[model samples]
Target: MKITFLGTGTSQGVPVIACPCRVCKSDSAKDKRLRSSVLVQLKKSNIVIDAGPDFRYQMLREDVKLLDAILITHSHKDHIAGLDDVRSYNYLQKRPMDIYASVRDQETIKQEFSYAFREYLYPGVPVINLHNIQQGIRINGADIEVLPVLHMKMEVYGYKIGDFAYITDANFIPAETMAKLMDCKVIVLNALRKEPHVSHYNLEEAVRVLEFLRPEKAYLTHISHLMGFHEEVEKELPGFIRLAYDGLELDIPNSWSE
Candidate 1:
């Protein structure tokens, strides 16, 4: 399976509007980030995790022609705002996009995009089928396991597919979720900055969790301009862990050879 970091920045993204931070002004391309999101390409299906405000551009930049589903982590606007653009896929695929989210999040989606849920929908509206996430839910042949964690007080979901796991917009990961992540070969976690954050993990905390999970490889995402330049921050992490940037891609075997 292949994984792509569609966007790695926090809600406002890198180069935050009207901010003259050094990290944002850096010349490196890695410093330019969009909102947090990822694309997972499996043997028979392609799925996207989160559809933030940058969704359209991310999809166009990647030239994604086929998409099977979208897995939402929570109801936060940064995670679900660009869902309206799924209409492009609906037009091309000639079917309703299948979206998986928690029951509470589904309600929020309906509220946010009430036009799509109307009995008599207007033309050209995004067509989507909402599925409440549950055990044994599979997209095509890929089995997805939901990892529930906490974004401050709100419940958020991380996901495990095969030997790859992804978690973002989280500060507290429950013990049960940690157990589910133990065997993952590759893991992605959020690290907003060097300082402590109330709803997101800081660099130190993210490193500690990755160290405990001990995945063969770990990546930090959902970064902020405050995290410092990508090249420098990366050097501070363990060799097994790296900071993920927009457009970063990874290929993982279905199972470890060992």
Candidate 2:
């Protein structure tokens, strides 16, 4: 399995409009981020988690040619805003994009992109097949497990595929959900900043979760400008943990257990 970090920034993304924070102004490429998202390429599957506002550019930058499915983590604009761009794939593949999401997020998608769902829609509208994910789903020979977590007051879902798990936009994870993460070889969690926040995990809180989970490799994503420079913050992380940047890729062996 090959995992790609498409984007790693918070909702507004790095270099927020009209803002002049040091981290935002940094010249390093690592500091420049799009919204948070990732693409998971399995043996015979290509799936993306979270479309976000930068979906179009992320795909273009990566020169992606095939996308089998998309998994939505939540209904937030930063996560689903760019879903409309899937029309490009619809045109190229001649098939409806398979979209997996909770019922609540499906409602949000319907409201946000009513034109696409209209019975008599335009020919160019994005074509999508919505699948409500309650327990788990199977696609292209891979089984996915949905782990529920909390994003402030709203409930969100994290996904576990083989030995890799991804959880973002989450502030609190229930004990049961934490248990679901057991045996994961790699985990990607949100770490917004050093200071605590109401709707997202701070660096310390994320680190604590990593310590408890004890994944062989842990990456922090969904970063904010307040998180400080990537290099500086990375120096403070444990040896096995690293800051994920756009375009970062990791190759995982077929074995789910190490």
- In candidate 2, stretches whose alpha carbon ends up further than 4 angstroms from where it belongs are 256-258
Q: Write the per-residue lDDT of candidate 1 for residues 92-210, one digit (tens) a residue.
A: 99999999999999999999999999999999999999998866468886789999999999999999999999999999999989999999999999999999999999999999999
Span of ten consecutive residues with least summed lDDT in model 2: 249-258
lDDT against the true structure, each candidate? 0.94, 0.93
TM-score of 1: 0.98
Each model's backbone clash number: 0, 0
In the order shown, the candidates' Cα RMSDs to the true structure are 1.8, 1.6
- State which candidate has the highest lDDT: 1
Per-residue error (Å), model 1, residue 43: 0.6
TM-score of 2: 0.98
| lDDT for each residue of candidate 2 in 6-109, tens digit (9 for 90 to 100) | 99999999989888778888999999989999999887878999999999999999988999999999989999999999999998999999999999999999
